[model samples]
Target: MTFSEKLRELMTARGLGLRELARLAPCDSGYLAHMREGRRIPSAKLAERLDQVLDAGGELAALVPARRARRKTPKGKAGASIARRDVLALAGAAGLPRGLSGPVAPELADYFRDQLAGHYTADRHLGPFRLIPTAAAQYDLLCDLANAARGTLRPRLWSLAAGYAAFLGWLYQDGGNIDRSVYWHDVMLERAHRSNDRQLVAFALHNKAMLHADLLDGQGVLELTRAALQEESALVPKVRVLALQQTAHGISLTEDGDARDECDCLLDQAAALVDQIDDAYPWGGACLTPHYIDIQRATCLVRLGKAADALTLWERIMPSLRAAGARRDAGVFLARQAQAYAVHHEPEHAVTVAGEVVELANATGSERMRRELSALRTRMRPWAKEPPGRQLQELLSSMGGHT
Candidate 1:
């Protein structure tokens, strides 16, 4: 049977309606409806909630998309079932790994080392954005290594786990199982404290600030970002600076002029230090290019209502953003572009860009992106019946959403 079929059967057997299922699962009813209709796939985090609510022996597979479902080969043989167990093993490994085999299998050590660096960098580029399950897999492997080798593991191992936990907290802002992300963050922070690694602490705080930003808790963002900046060392790694910058950007959203000014100063400091620091390379996932900076500046300009300036920056940065396979990032830039166009009273342009935003948001299953697009739709509402307003409304309605 298909995953959705299983879900339908389970719900019926349990005497639950769609709304009741959504209530028990703690997600939007529409989101649940979409899943039931096979129009949407539940996130790993969401599946876990459904598992508990349905009392399905923690079998999340019953709700996985049909495409992701395990295949049964022969009755006596196990294929995907074993694969699923391996997947679970890896997840459990996130709690703790056996240990870093020093004299380690060169390949194993290399994988852990590479994974650690990759996750840290990935955290930077995502900018507190929650990651999909595939992306989270990287951190889980590194976490396993850290957990398995308590005393024998290198200090960097602890840093890796803490950094990953911090990233997880940012990515799964609303839907994640708290036990792994937030709870893990607390553990990571405590570990960082024990290690007395201020850089790691700062990085973790920056991530926590992003989580607060996701919650629209601007005060929390400011408080945590400030703490992170305080702990950031002049000689900190470049990725660490990027982490701080993400928090600074979050602070900019608070409309605090003083915090904004301070953030600017810190940006300048980061830039100046960028040239002087040796080996202060971009973390693999967090590579900051001139274009990335321009995008960041443009975002700030938009929030500051410097629409013309933001437009100029967007025009210049669009080529590179599109070239980087940064579809999600591009989608965001387009959403902002739509907003800037609306602010400038260019409805036609706003309509064009908003279309791009909705398309990308839908493709990525990004509710956050959809929310931003929804806000743009609201701003465009007063001009109803116009091509722009009609375009926005049509897109929202198609998504089964409203402003």
Candidate 2:
């Protein structure tokens, strides 16, 4: 029987409807229906998923031709590349192999690397509610191609998968989904290990430290960071700084008497590495610079109750953060500054800055900033019945109680 005939028969025998099978398919449900009617061709992955869904025992998959006819696509601007998602879909449609041997392998790598950079920026502009689903979907598609990839192509594909997972981990963490954040962090570690690249693996392990951060598990962060740094032989400047930053954060969180001194020293060490590093990668932090490290340093100092000092450093670097298109982060930093003000008993300015944070969070839809706002509201408890505190509460209520 033809592929569709067999699919229909299987559905009939199983008492499954097209929509039901399509819902369980790996690809878009709408696309499955179109292919079922012969309005479009089925891809290898699509056929594979369909076979498994219908219990065809690989029969439906085997029906996919070795190759498919290419369709025309709109070309990108002079230098821009097509989105890799489209590339994968087209390859699936044409039954073409993917990997180092595939024509799109090199282009796909470049495309993803570039998008990785763009996403770094997008993370600043786009809220987690918007970016999380997109990144998760991209990770899923990338994983499929990476699994099918072979030979020399495996390294780049795996690296992309791991990196995307890390990105998702960060996004989910920002979205306040701790479990999902940890899940992607684990996926990053698994994918990176599969790639067998020490540097990428180190990047993945370092990402787990971030997952523990939401829970303020200083010991967990320190252990994960130490594990990541053990790959020092594979370390680049970016990973080095990231590992150090987490170390600083963990140290600050600990109750040790010397934690402040140790954390301060680690920040200095990370700073020294900043001058030596000049390369950026898709893995870990390709955006690590002196400013980034300093931001971590200031944040650490704030947590350690060195409010005045941290506020000084934060103001000095505020311009840099703003210029980087990190409006969401900028809002968080403002909240930190406001926190410092509250600690210094400067209630008026603290409340003023808190207002700015509320405005920023509303504009960006950043759960990170929202969490900070909530913290600020709690901090305002002493003054809750006061005008500034009352105003902050009203602002928070306007955000659907996110604050």
The list of candidate 1 runs beyond 4 A from truth reads 1-11, 16-109, 116-131, 134-144, 150-154, 173-196, 257-263, 275-287, 400-403
lDDT of 2 by residue, 69-132 (tens): 3423246521111244465656645554654234334455566677777786778776665565
TM-score of each: 0.69, 0.75
137-241: candidate 1 lDDT, tens digit per residue: 545555555554445454555565565555555455423233335655676677667546676676667666756665567788778777777745543656455
Clashing pairs in model 2, backbone N/Cα/C closer than 3 A: none
Cα-based lDDT for every prediction:
0.60, 0.72
The C-alpha local distance difference test score for the whole of candidate 2 amounts to 0.72
Superposed on all Cα atoms, the candidates' RMSDs to the truth, in angstroms, are: 6.9, 7.3
Best by lDDT: 2
Candidate 2's TM-score: 0.75
